[model samples]
Target: MQRNAFMLLMDEPRSTLDPIATAQVDELIDELRQNYLVAVVTHAMHQAARVSQKTAFLHLGNLVEYGETGTVFANPTDPRTESYITGRIG
Candidate 1:
């Protein structure tokens, strides 16, 4: 039952969803976060921005960065992170 669950991990849960439905799912995730640690693994930068406070960017079996979402997004220390986020040399 949903009541017994402590965390929810979704992998690209919005990939197949339409824009409207994706928003609804984001809202639902926010609500769920009130009670659990939600771990969402997504390739979508915007989706991660929407539902998570912390993000872990993994590249080729390596853990690139682990920190607050704002910090990671605004000023990523890794060159890989920079390239990925800015889309300049990815």
Candidate 2:
């Protein structure tokens, strides 16, 4: 029997990796997206921008905003999203 995964979930995938290793992991993630639904959970805003096509902003277990990554980062509709992305709040 054989099995395959259609999705990949990563929590802070690069958190512990050194700079070179992190870049390598990020590259792998880019390749994986061609065949899998890649969901990455990270506190690193820059990484999110780099790796995701869509962005979901969640605060206190509540989903605040979701949209294209560029829009979410450039023009978030929710104040909470704006605050968090702008370094005004965590």
Candidate 3:
């Protein structure tokens, strides 16, 4: 049988995987992006920066920022987003 999926939602997809396995999953996510919208929820900032084209920052159950990954990482507008990314807060 053939199946079709529109979007993929993942929560901490690599939280338990070893380095090699994590790389493999990252690659898979890259490939899947060609055909599906992928949303990943993770606490690993580096992974999020590496794998996401767009990023969102949430704090205390509120949305703080959302934008292109590079901008979000390099020039976040919110102080809380900057703090979390810079390891000052979480």
Candidate 4:
């Protein structure tokens, strides 16, 4: 069957996969982004950097920052965001 989707919410879709499988899933998510708004919640910062066009960084149930993925990861405006992305915090 076929269906129409406006947005896709994926929470660690690659969690249990090995490197090869994770790469495959990342590729598929990238492809799917062409047609759907894909929101991924992942702890893997590298994976987030790869597949997301926009990113939202959260800490302790609070939103620290939200913006273009590159900007948030490369030059975050908030110290909390920076700390988390830089491995200062888990």
Question: CA lDDT of each candidate?
Answer: 0.87, 0.91, 0.92, 0.91
Off by over 4 Å in 1: 1-3
Per-residue lDDT of model 2, residues 8-74, tens digit only: 8999998978889888888998998998899999998988999899999999999999999999999
Better of 1 and 2 by TM-score: 2
Which pairs clash (backbone N, Cα, C closer than 3 Å) in model 1?
none
Cα lDDT of model 1 by residue, 1-90, tens digit = 377899888889799899999999999899989988899988878888778899898989999898999988889889898788777664
- lDDT head-to-head 1 vs 3, winner: 3
Q: What is the TM-score ranking, best to worst?
A: 2, 3, 4, 1
Distance (Å) between predicted and true CA of 88, model 4? 0.6
lDDT (Cα) of model 3: 0.92
Candidate number with greatest lDDT: 3
Q: Model 4 Cα displacement at 76 (Å)?
A: 0.9
Candidates' RMSD to native: 1.7, 2.0, 1.9, 1.6
Prediction-by-prediction clash tally: 0, 0, 0, 0
Sliding window of 10 residues with minimal summed lDDT for model 1? 81-90
Q: What is the lDDT of candidate 4?
A: 0.91
Q: Candidate 3 or 4, higher lDDT? A: 3
| lDDT value, candidate 2, whole model | 0.91
